[model samples]
Target: MIRVFGMHNIQPLLNKVYPKATTANGVYIYDEYGKAYLDGSSGAVTCSLGHSHPRLIPYIKQQLDKLQFVYRSQFGSEEAEQLATRLFEHSPERIYAHSFFVNSGTEAIETAMKTAVQYWQEKGFPSKQQFITRWKSYHGITVGALSLSGHPLRRQRFESTLEKYPRLKADLENDTLEKLTEEFVQVIESIGANHIAAFVAEPIVGAAGTALTPQAGYYQEMKKVCEHYQILFITDEVMTGLGRTGTWFGIEHWNTTADIVAIGKSLGAGYAPIAATLMTDEILEPIKNGSGLIMSGHTYSGHPLSCATANRVLEIIEEEQLLDNVNTQGEYIKQQLNVLKENYPVIQHVRGKGLMLGVEFDPARKGFQQKLIERCFQNGLLVYPSVGGPEGKDENGILVSPPFIISRSEADELLAKLDQSLNEINQ
Candidate 1:
C-alpha cells in the first residue's frame, strides 16, 4: 500500500504539505477536504478545457477502447495522421506541414532542436549547429532544450553541463525593433551564421518574462534576418498554441510564420500527454529525401490513445468556438486586471493575449509575490508564478490564465476571488 500523505514519493514542494486534489470540474479543483480552488492559472497555463470536461472524458474512453498504444515504427494510426493534419491546418499559412509527435513540451523542444540540426545536416551544412535565443525566454527543461533557453534560475544548478548557445540580451519590453533585430545580426556576425542551427523564441515570452510582448514588427525583422543569414527560425509555441491565444498559433497575431514550431500544453489541453515538432515542407523534404528519416523519436512518439484524445480535444475547441470566447473573456479579464493594477500599487505590469494573461508585481517588495500567492490560495484561487523584474530573475510574476471554456459568471467569481486575495495581501 502507498503512503497517502507526508514524505511521499511525489513531492512538488518538498518542504511544504501541498494540497491533494480530490476532484475537479470546469474551472474549480476540489481539495481532499472539499474546498474548491478556482483554477485561475489553468494548471500551469495548460488545461485549456478545464478539469474533467464532460465531452472529453467520453471521447477518451472511446479511444481507449479502440487502441491504447502503438510504437511509431511498427504501425501508423489514423489518430496521429488527423492530429498532424489538424496542427498543420491551424498553423500560420499552413507552412508547418509536418508534425513529429512527442509526449511533452520538453520532448517537443528537444526534438525541435534535433530537427533543426538534422535539416541543416541533410542540406549539406552540418556546421549550422549553434542556435540564437533571447535572454528573457524559456524553451523547456531538458538539457538539450535548456541549452537554448536563457532563463537564469532554471539553468543555475546545471550551468556547467549546458551548451553555450548565443543568448541575445536585448529587452523585449523597452528595446526598439531595430535594436533588437541588430542584436541578432551582431550575434550572428560574431558567431558566424554558418555555424548556427536556428534562432528560437517564444512569440509572447511566458514564465521567464511574465507575458512580455515585443514590438509589432519584431518577428518580421527577425524572420528577415534568419532568411538573410540562412538560419531557421523556430517558435516555441508550447504555451501559446491551440486556442489559448485567440489565434490558433501565437505567431499568426504578427502576420508571420516560423520554419519550425514546437507546440505542447494546450495541444493536449489537460486531456492527454501529447506534443509535436512542426515544420514546413522545405524543412522536411530534404531530410525525408536524404536521410529517409527524421533521426529523432521516442517509444511513445505516436501513442494512438494519446493522439486520439488530443484530436478530440482540438475538435471540441473548434466545435465550441472557444477561440471567440478566449477573446471575449480575455478582454474582460484583462480590463479588470488593469483596474486591479490601478488600485494595487504593487502590480507593475499586466500583459498578455487572449486567455493567457500575466501580472507582475514590484519585485523590490520583499516576499510580495509569495504573500499574494498565499493569500490567493487561502481565498480558494490558484495562480502560476513567473519570473519578472529588470533582470528577469525575480519570482514577482503570476500568470492569470483561466480555462477558455470559462463563462461570464465564472469569470466574475474568479476576479472577485483575486480581488479579495489582493486585498488580503494589502493588509
Candidate 2:
C-alpha cells in the first residue's frame, strides 16, 4: 500500500504542528482525535454563525445544485441583486444605495479605494487620489489596501512598494472630539484636501488596535471635517459588520454614516468567501452621470453560490433575532470580564461594543498575550491575538469576539475557560 501525503500549507507557524480539525458543529471544532475546541475568536472574527451550522448546510447544498459560478460582465444573478438590496435595507437609512460584491475583505477595500478615486474623477478633480488613514488600523492584505493601512507589522515587508499615504497618529480614545477634529483639519489642510480622495478608518479598530473604540462624538466630528474638505469618508467594517456589533452596521452605534463602507467576515458566516463595498447614492450619482460605470469588479465578483450563502446567512440572523442575543450575551461577557480585570492586574483594559470585545494586557508584562493564548488552546478554548500599546505595534491584546448565536450557558462556558486560562498563565 502506498501512502499519499497532501501538500503542506504555509500557515502562520512553520515550525509548529497545529491540531487537525476533523469536524465542527456550533461553537466547537473537533480535532481528529475527537477533542473539542471552543471557537473563541470566531476564526479571526469571521465565523459569526459558528461551525457546521445545520441551517446553513442545506441552504448551501440547494444553492450549489441550482446555480454556482457566473462571470460578472457576462450576466447578472438575482442572488447578487437580492443580497445587495438586503444589505442596503439593513444599513443606516440614506447610507448605502448600492453594493459592489467581491471575493474577500481586501478586494472589497481595493474596490472601495478605486470607487472613491473614480467618484472624485467624475466630479472633475483627478488630483483627489491620496487617502488619509489612522495609524491604528488594518484595512486589508492587498497592495492597494496595504498602501492605505497603517498597520506597521503587516506593512513592513511591502513598505518599499506601498504608497506614501499619510498615517495620522491621532489618539481616538484619549483626545477630545474637538482636538481630534482639529487634528483632522490640520492634516487635510497640510495635504490640501483637493489632493485627497477619502479618509478611511475602521468603525472600531479591530486586529490592529484590539477593538479600540472611539468616543461617542468621534465619528460625527470626523465626518464633519471630511465633509468640510469635500473628502469622502470610508469605514472599514469588515470585522464589525452584519450584526457582530449588535447592530446591522457598527457605525450605526454612533448614528453616523460613511460615504463608502466595506463589509465582510460575517456576511458569509464561515459558509462562503464573500465581501462587499457599499456606497451611498450621492457617491454613485456623480459617477453614474459622468462615466456611466463605477469601474470595479472581479471575474467571480458576484458568484451566485457565495451570494446565496451570504444572503441566507443574513436571513437567519434576521429570522433568529441574533442581534438581541449578541447584546444580551455580550453584556454578560463584558460584565464578567470586568470582574476578572478587577481580580487580575494583567488585564489592564476591556473595551468594544456588543460581542466584538477586546482585552488589553499590561504592556510592562511583555508576551503575556501569547502565553494566555497558548494556555487557552491547551484548555480547549480559542482566542484571536491583537496589537495594543501607545504605538499600537505591541502584540499585547486579545479579541474575544465569538459567534453571535452564543447563548447564556455557552457564554458561561467560554468565560469559565477563559478564566481558567488566565489563572494558569498568572501562575
Per-model TM-score on C-alpha atoms? 0.98, 0.98
Tens digit per residue, CA lDDT, model 1, 212-240? 88878889999999999999999999998
Q: Candidate 2 on 47-115: residue-level lDDT in tens? A: 999998888899899999999998988889999999999998998975698999998999989989999
Specify the highest-lDDT model's number: 2
Instruction: Give the CA lDDT, 0 to 100, for residue 159 in model 1.
Output: 98
User: lDDT for each of the candidates?
Assistant: 0.91, 0.91
Q: What is the alpha-carbon lDDT for the whole of candidate 2?
A: 0.91
